[model samples]
Target: MIQVKKETLYAGMLKGLLTTFDLAKIIIPVSIVVTILGKSGALEFLADFAAPLMRVFGLSGKAALALFSGYFINLYAAIGVILTLSLTLKELMIIGVMLMLSHSLFMELAISKKAGCSLFYVLLVRLIPSLLVGILGGWLF
Candidate 1:
């Protein structure tokens, strides 16, 4: 026997739509803002400030903005920043790998704390692996 109610289907569709809308709310604004910052040279300033450090990861200084966005805000924001820039495949790969390892630090940290995990340990566990992987990916690619 199988049962699929119309109301349940409608509710599921609505929930999916709402989730998409929520993601769009964050992604669209962030894409626009990063685009504006790129055009206005603000990202260049940030890149310069982070250049020396970013070089270690085989990324340009400008990529610092994407990393910052990914770490603090969310991966979608980082994607927006990345899309605005003209990066090589290798650069993109390094950033992609790094972001996969660690993103949404503030939100995840709060969640971890609420779940009774040590904040410092949570941060260290995520960040160290991200950095190491970034370094290795940079070297390999």
Candidate 2:
């Protein structure tokens, strides 16, 4: 019993470490790239471009980068983008809730497709709720 417990503990620790490493691989590079883009003013230009649409969610243009990253990439990438920007707590909460509702779109859509779901339906279901939450959260929060 003692040996079994030790093995289980070690296995759990190893799995946790591997998961952290996997997330770091995605997050670190994204953070670095975002930082560079920000320094180059590229992020600002893109932020301006996205500002109008992002305004509907009550987020700043910079926050849109995180939203796009979350929708297209994964939550980890969005987190990376979020880390590089200075945002208010309200903005963070609004975008955070939005991402929670509709993140990992590409991968989830692929899985949904494999499960015999239509891409359009999956996107509609995920996006509508997320958009509504973002709009409401922006107004109320």
The TM-scores of all predictions, comma-separated, are 0.87, 0.91
- The runs of at least 3 residues in candidate 1 whose Cα sits more than 4 Å from the true structure, single-residue gaps closed, are 1-8
RMSD of each predicted structure: 2.1, 2.3
Model 1: what TM-score? 0.87
lDDT of each: 0.89, 0.93
- Candidate 1: give the clashing pairs: none
Q: Which prediction has the highest TM-score against the true structure? A: 2
What digit string (tens of lDDT, one per residue) describes model 1 on residues 93-130? Answer: 99998999899999999999999999999999999999
Measured by C-alpha RMSD in angstroms, how accurate is candidate 1? 2.1
